[model samples]
Target chain A: MKLPRLLTRPIAQPPPHPSAQLVGDLAARLEASARRRLGRGLALRHIGTGGCDGCALELIATRNLVHELESLGLRFVDSPRHADALLVSGPVTRNMREALEQARAAMPEPGFVVALGDCAVDGGVFKGSYAVEGGVEAVMPPDLRLPGCPPSPRQVLEGLLALVEAQA
Target chain B: MTPAEFLRQPPAQGPTHALTEPQWEALAADPELPLLALWGEPGVVRAAFQDGNALRLVALAAPEGQYPALSPARPAAALFERAVHDLWALEPVGTQDGRPWLDHGRWPVLNPLSGRPVRHGGAPPQPEFLPAEGHALHRLPLGPILPGIGEPAYLHLAVAGEAVVRMEARLGYAHKGVLALMPGKSPRAAARFPARLQAEATVAHSLAFALAAEKATGTEPPPRAVVLRAVMAEIERLSVHLHIWAQVLALAGPPALADQAALARETMLAASQIAFGHRLLMDRVLPGGVALDLEERGLSILRDALLLLAEDLPRLARATLRHAGLVEALTGLGVIPPALAQDYTAGGPVARASGVMVDARLGPDASPYDELELEIPLHPEGDAAARLRQRIAETAESRRLLAVMLDSLPDGPIITPLPQRGGEGVALVEGPHGPCMAWLALDDGGLIRAAMARDPAWALWPLAEAAAAGAGLEQLPLLLAGFGLTMSGMDL
Candidate 1:
């Protein structure tokens, strides 16, 4: 009889992400222009349209418990006016079109967007619904996309980290 | 003839009992059966009510569009009625507050459920939201997009000075027409909708749908399958409660406590994955029984985790209660009067905190919990503190119950094949929040014709109005944190 392992196995090394390379390019260009304008590091404002609510759960966990995104110089802002980037989840719904647009307009220029969850990338299971308007691209183009029903907390952390390191 | 005689079960074997308007009104407002849902189809509308041990199902025919409203008598039916109108275009004749709930009129189709043809190009209907206006009373909107984490819901607060005069919550931003999508799909395939509606309460919703399907088709799952279902439900309850407590702690600051609460939840999630294959136990509970059987090693890990939870949760709860300023902020905050809880039929911690002692598992209904002696936590305060205390008590109870069910684990098949013929069934499973119910009506082809899954959110969301009524604006977050209402569940 074997005693089963209780702990989760460590996450394996990831292949290089094309979005990561693309986001790195954008961040590098944006950082050169905007370093003098902003005081603190990158700020995130998240908008949910219509989703299963999985990514937001993992997002909060990453920021609050394990990853503590603030330590890496990323703070979640209440107002989009203070944000440098927008973290959007769920498929864009027609009802939320105005709200999503206004939030993006309010944010400062270099309006970086990171789409979270498979729904945000491609609308996942909710794609065909009459209310859904497809992914973040329907309203705002995403600089980077994190894919999963919900990508793990570690995955969320990795995506944000990649974007920040790209500015360097 | 007596009303019972006229309400004979429809020959289709679906749980529907077709009734005239007079019969529907009489049965709907009957002091016995409480109306659960009133939804619509092409020409006919269905009303489901839970009457004591047996569920009473009734349907009303609306040839000319309008039908008598149930919300005038039972306040809980308002949202369902509004939903019916929004999707089906079937008007609830005299229901007060005829405002649309789900339809923002932004869709390509006017009434998507009405089978009205969608035009290729059309102007979107512009939704107008007019808040309560008074001198120095301004509307403060919270979220279609909130600060940190959550599903999209807009709570319109009309504030006069420091007090919230009225709070009108506008949901349906997450409405993907989950109920509409279920029809014409196999029961097994449609199972995914309910499972993801509230991601935190996946197993409970899945189990509810499964049990409902079983009841409709008249197939009782094996005892082992029943026990396994209970096991998953209990684990889900534990995870959701822990997550709620973590949110509350984060709100009642000092940050460290919230971090600890999250760590505990992570530990629970890891255990679930080790036992089952998924972290949230998504797609695990099915129509017949369960998706996977737990191996010996998985069982061992689960047992150990439950034991650890039993030991750790109580200690964490005590520390939280004793923490400086927590009691001051939590107690007497967001106090909900007993009347509000009863009127709305608020279940779970919200109702228990208000001292309403109702739990699905403890009832006379037979299932996995028939033999085990269980305690339903009752706190009479109905405040934020009481709700917190109730969640802690329930979490500990879940851990204990999980241990008990695991010990008496049976040795038979984990699934019983579902019947070839389709029928109607209703299931009630105790979610961490409260009793989450699934009422399923499958067609002769064993595919879903109509289905409705009601989360405890239906009962609890209205109480947010009562809870925030007299409280100052400063205390709203504490109230919301303790309440732990799911916008996703409500919107769906």
Candidate 2:
């Protein structure tokens, strides 16, 4: 059966797991950058301007005891201005499109954007809704994508860790 | 509509209706009975009130003019009326606070559901938010984007120094016009909207849609299907309550306590995946019946998981509640009185915390809940601590129900064939949040004519404002977290 043309748009697909090669390479780079690091800590900001709360729940899971992204020196910041990277989830609703843009703009220079879930990548089931604006790429392209209705907490951690390693 | 036509229940057991629009005001007058369902269509609007097993429904067909809005008499009708005006353009005469609720006036078309063109102009400017003002109080706008909040919703908090004097939530950032999408699709296809409303509560929503579809189409799932659907719903509630407990803990304090809660929740999700093939349980329920059945291995995993959780959860709840800081912080913050809860129609834990005894599970609805020895835990204080304790109690109860269902798993076919005919039907399911409902009308070709899925959160968000007033600004997170309302559920 043919899929709807709008939903068939190219969305970044996650590798079965995080790219071990890139994650390793980035880890090496981070280890040698103590002098370059400002050491203000990893102030990551998450934005889920639309879509269901699935990705947000899994993302929160990464902060709990089992996944402990905090112990990895990462923490959530209240404002986008204080963040090093923007972790975005869900399809961008039309109303939230501007807020998403403004949030990305508020982040200081060299900040990366990581989009989570199929909704963020390709708008998932909400693509055809009149109130929705297709996907995250419609507003700003993401540096990383983790796909699923909600990618598992392990998958979310892999994506965030890889993003941090790349920045380091 | 005439009183005689209104004084009848749908063949399927939806909240029963028996009054005209004017009588609806009388139903609203009884503060003890909570109003459960409210929505509108062209020519008519409907409301359902619940008292134990009995439901009093009222439908008003305006004689080609504005009908009175119950919002003036019932504060609970605020969101439903605003939404009715926004979507159907059915002006509620004498309605208070008619400012757009769902529509931000940003659409190229006004009343898109009613198919009206944008009225001779571009979308108007975003209106300024005029909140209820007070002395020495300043407004602090919260979000349409918070990294941690899963959906796009804003909160206007009236603050005096460090104290939150009041809260006004502005949602609709996630409103996807679900009703608009419902029409023209087959009931099977439309099932996706109700299920996706809130992923955490997917089972309850889908079950509601399935129930509504089954009712409208005059089809029935096999006995086995009903038992399985109930089990899935209980599992969904378990996972949700566990996750909410963890979230409330993490948002407040004691990250270590949150971790234990997450571990138990993860165990449930893993078992759910092993049984249902979906961690979130989306699309597992379809119209007329379930999409599939759980295998023996899946049932065993769930049975084992429940046993472990039953032993571990109470210990976790005690440890967290006994913590000195938690006790001090949660004790008196965000106390909504029983009268206010009834007035605002606070739902799920929020309503139950304030001593509102309304549970669809315990009602005269056609479900196995009437068969099982289930307990709906409630609290009287209506404070953050009471809400937290309420969740802990409900989580334990959900686990107990899961064990009972799994042990007595019925043997039969899982689904009924989808009907090709059309009719009007309504479904009510007690979701993790509280009671969620769905209404659908099918066309001659078996396409959906109109549909509405009522999330319990829609009625509860306004009560969040009442709950947050007079609490310290720092305590707002705990207050909001304990209430555990979802923004997407509200907007949709």
Candidate 3:
């Protein structure tokens, strides 16, 4: 019995994407930093404060096989209590300000904050809207800021690596 | 009047018809005409409907800061009316659910989009979830902030034992005051707002906005630009459908298959970046025409990417069907009856899965799609499985459309000069999710006087609530993944 051509044909393996390579390098750096300073892996808790979901989609892409950050002992946790970092996205809208503060307060001492997009960094396109309180900085200071309309997965990994290195 | 009767009348070339109060009420209660969108601007409120082939807009004056409620007749008008009241301080005379829709009471100004904005100082009001009373029933609250990277939205679930008795979603956590932001800016400068309304449907929303602006100014983009816009839209649909498949597969089982879907999506994104200079194709479709042209090298890259997706998607679908765990988890789960879907006017895969054959691409406003071969996938089951299958079918159809458009690629300039002039225009484009409508009133200087972009999610969210009513509480995420809705699009 012969299988259909679709099942029989080998799945094409495109060359490793440049973002994958950048993620690999960043993972190596983060792993070394974790061993040297924290004696444990980093745990991040993400919150979408209120911009478009482009940054969130890119952030999720970082967990894919090509950019598997989890393999480097870094993972997203369900609660801020278990997190070493609070990864915030969007413009920190007024409706989300309390929720954002509550998540930050629940984290352990010295848990850093990383703002993940232009909206999070300084309210990018939604700057003067009445519904938003500008950016993450308006609610609380961020330890690191990654800016793009919404940064790519490679840029996200790079930003994480920078945060880890600076903390170490 | 029935849709057939409305179609018999001569088509009105004007953007909107000024209807008397009685006429507006009659149209609202017609039952046969599906309401596309209802929005307010100053002293007027406009309602758009699918009048056979063309979009019909009817306007009524709200001089006393109030108007007759359409929700009394068309149950689907409930959300739209609530949103209008929230943003414009226009009272819906006899609405059953007059709760604040988009204004969560946290904004610095109340009725921010109203002509005269007022400052509010009190603490934001807590949401009032619908009551669910039963013995041993407990409430389960999820989000505004949940586990995993997704948009923020609050869900209140009333569960009894293992089953959910009721589910009410309190969204508006992601609202950015988009309506208030668009009014004063030129269409070129304000194009970014519509593009950002829904990240997954950026191209669809941008195209709809551009079409509305172009129609308002009576500008016609070159032939090449029209075809390229359609090409980009097809690519967007493919990518979004793939992403939804990846998410559904991740939830149902067989993680390896999920990876395959994710990789395919990545390939599409990479191709988009190579062709249009942006992964999501944001800001690529502007008012007069597209911002960038497809060069020869980029065109070949896109062709190769589409071919790869065409081959890979079928294998993933086959694997998914063979997995018994996925099959059992999805089959007969979160079922939405066809009657309920039609009543709510659900669109996209959700509506198509329930056997609704409506597609904006096949409508009168569909330009290039009118020339291309477009197929509407229909499933009678209306389950999670059916929705997934609908996406798979749509993905194949989009691939075929892309191949044809690329083969017959036209040659010409990409843009036309949009003269600064006053007019109103409405456009409906079939987004990946469903029919997305954009209506705009342009000032003499081509600045936007008023605008509204409606995502199909508005109709689908209520259907999702209906689907979740009798399902097990554990199945909530699977049901949501099946719907694949974005809160920003709704909240905007």
Task: Count clashes in each candidate, considering only residues at least 3 apart in sequence or on different chains.
Answer: 1, 2, 0
The root-mean-square deviation over C-alpha atoms between each candidate and the true structure, in angstroms, is 4.6, 7.6, 3.7
Alpha-carbon lDDT of model 1: 0.77
Better of 1 and 3 by TM-score: 3
RMSD of 1: 4.6
- Binned by DockQ into CAPRI classes (incorrect, acceptable, medium, high), candidate 1 is medium
- Tens-digit lDDT string for candidate 1 (B27-99): 6565344565667776678776654334567778888768888787778888888888888888887788788
DockQ, every prediction: 0.55, 0.44, 0.67
Q: Which residue runs of candidate 3 sit more than 4 Å off their true CA positions? A: A1-40, B1-13
Fnat for each predicted structure, in order: 0.65, 0.64, 0.71
Off by over 4 Å in 1: A1-41, B1-14, B28-32, B52-54, B117-135, B363-366
- Clashing pairs in model 2, backbone N/Cα/C closer than 3 A: A46-B147, B17-B57
The DockQ-derived docking category for candidate 3 is: medium
TM-score of chain B of each: 0.93, 0.93, 0.97
**lDDT of each residue in B1-492, candidate 2, tens digit only:** 433234443623433443466665554444455566677666667766554644555566754635676676678877788877777777777776888888876655677665553452465566556566677888788887853646778888779899887778888888776777788899898888888888777898888888888888889788888888988998888888888888778877587788778878887887888999888888889987788798889888888888778767888989888988887888888888888877765567777888887777876555788888778887898888888888888888888787888888789888877777778777677888877878788888899988778887876787787777788887777777777788787688
Candidate by candidate, in order, the iRMS in Å equals: 1.5, 1.7, 0.9
Stretches of model 2 off by over 4 angstroms after superposition: A1-17, A20-43, A71-73, A165-168, B1-34, B53-57, B62-65, B117-124, B128-133
Highest TM-score scorer: 3
lDDT of 1 by residue, A1-168 (tens): 643122343322342343656666756666665643343367888777777777787777776544566776778888889888888888787777778889889988866788898888987777788878888888777877889877877778777777766664
